[model samples]
Target: MIDLRSDTVTRPTEAMLESMREATFGDDSRDGDATVQKLEALAAERTGKETGAFMPSGTMANLVAMLAHANRGGEVLLEDGSHTLNAELGGIAGVAGLFYRGIHGKRGAMDPDALREAIRPVTRYHMGTALVWMENTHNRSGGAVLPLAHMQAVYGLAREKGVPVHLDGARIFNAAISLGCAASEISQYSDSVCFCVSKGLSAPVGSVLCGGAAFIERARAYRRMVGGNMRQAGPLAAAGIVALETMVDRLVEDHQTAKRLAEGLTRTDASLCDPKDVETNLVRVDVRKSGRRAAQWSADLKSKGVLVAPADLYALRFVTHRHISAPDVDAAVGAFAELWKKS
Candidate 1:
């Protein structure tokens, strides 16, 4: 099947497999593994941060960031459709002991004026804003890339309120390629950032959280508290290192394929998707006009040898990665068109 469900389905490359075979197996939780340290340093250098700590997943990295940055009952301000609020299973409140205020946004960017109104100082009546959050290539917004100018404005406002910022940059490299800039250029606006190597990057497992040395040191303790410390994680780090070195540049190809798929779907039915909305490797299709739920569409397409995920009642999310090709995109589009005609 042409698996357009998510980039998380991507497998490791041969280079990553060979590196994992020869990787050092030192204990990371005790003395710190050499391979893991190397991977962390590389993650830090890429995101323009002083240091980084390896985590088992992006969810853990984000939870650790929240735990390290804020006290109990503090508030986190982020876009309403953010992955943290909608997808991370309420870890922000349940585990981190923080209250979250979802700021209204468009295409993953928070409204500057709305954000200005939301940030508050500690008072007996309200829990003050503790952290300002941002996400690049935001998942729920169909992989929308937040503009740098918008980020700067939000960061400036947060700084004025004496609040620190955290960026969920799981697809920062995808955002960088779409904007024609370095990942650091995007990450510079936030106090801390985390990115996953297991998604479009094609690493088997791992995410890295980067920030100031002291902040990362604190995050490491929180990482342990949240059960994120992997004792002998050198093999995973080895694959992540290879992913960082060799997999980033090719993400543009995935974006291109996604655009191709979107354009083709639009040609079949304009109500399905707008190609312009597809800025990266994800395509969010609106199937509300078809009088069929997205879950139904997903199952129909899967039966025709194409796989996709239902994002909501009337929306579907299609993701492209290294394994998908131009021909695969055309086939998926054809299958979708066939179903559209039947509907």
Candidate 2:
């Protein structure tokens, strides 16, 4: 089956699996696992951060960052469609006791002016804002790359206000590849950053959170509080190490395959949004004019061995990943064309 559902669906490569099997396990809570330490150091060096910590999932990494940055009752500024706001089960409010000030953004990229206006003043009788959160290659926004200049502007504004910025960079490597820039360029604009190795990188599990040593120390404590500390996490970290070392540069191939898919979809139906909007590994199709519900369309595609995700009642999404090659994309496109014709 051609699985265009999500990047997170990718399985680990044979090499990654072998690395995991050969990893030397040690106690993470006591002596600290060597593989985990090596992975953290490599991730920190790549992102140009002072320190890094490994978490089991992107959600935990994001939660750790949010908990470390904001105090109880403090507010955090975020895009309305951001993963931290919409996808993390409201952990910021439920666990951290922080309020969210959601500002709507175009294509999941917030305007600097909108972000500035979202910040609450200390005199506002509320807990006041403490942090600003940004997501790159935003999941809900068709994997849009948040422009570096815009991020710099927002970070500058937050720094002026003495508010820290935490970046939810789950697919940030995709953004960096798309922009032809180093990932560290984006890291420079954030006080803290979290990214997933399990996504496009095709690792079995793990995410990395990076920042200054003090902030990471606090985040580690929060991670433990949330019962996220694993005793022998080296096996997972070994896969993450391989992902960081080997899987990043190949993202350009995924982006190219996504463009091919987008082109095919647009040729099948021009009523959908322009294919130019598909800049990374995700393609969002507006199926409103097709006179078919998204769930029904998805089910139909699944029956034909071409899996995809329903974005809404009238929209759907396709995410190209490492497991999907150029030929697989062509086949999926053919499936989409046939389905559109039948519809």
For each candidate, give its TM-score against the true structure.
0.99, 0.97
Q: How accurate is candidate 2 locally (lDDT)?
A: 0.90
Question: Which consecutive 10 residues in model 2 have the weakest lDDT in total?
Answer: 117-126
Encode model 2's per-residue lDDT on 1-343: one tens digit a residue: 9999999998999989999999979988889999999999998987889989999999999988989988899999988889888778989999989989888798887866778777776775777888999999898889999999888988989898899999999998999999999889988999998899999999988999999999999999999999999889999999999998899999999999999888888888887657789899999888888899999989999988999999878889999998898889888878878988888
The Cα local distance difference test for each model comes to 0.96, 0.90
Mark the regions of model 2 whose C-alpha exceeds 4 Å error after superposition. Answer: none
Best by lDDT: 1
Clashing pairs in 1: none
lDDT of 1 by residue, 1-343 (tens): 9999999999999999999999999999999899999999999999999999999999999999999999999999999999999989999999999999999999999999899999999999988999999999999989999999999999999998899999999999999999999999999999999999999999989999999999999999999998988999999999999999999999999999999999999999998888999999999999999999999999999999999999999999999999999999999999999999999
Off by over 4 Å in 1: none
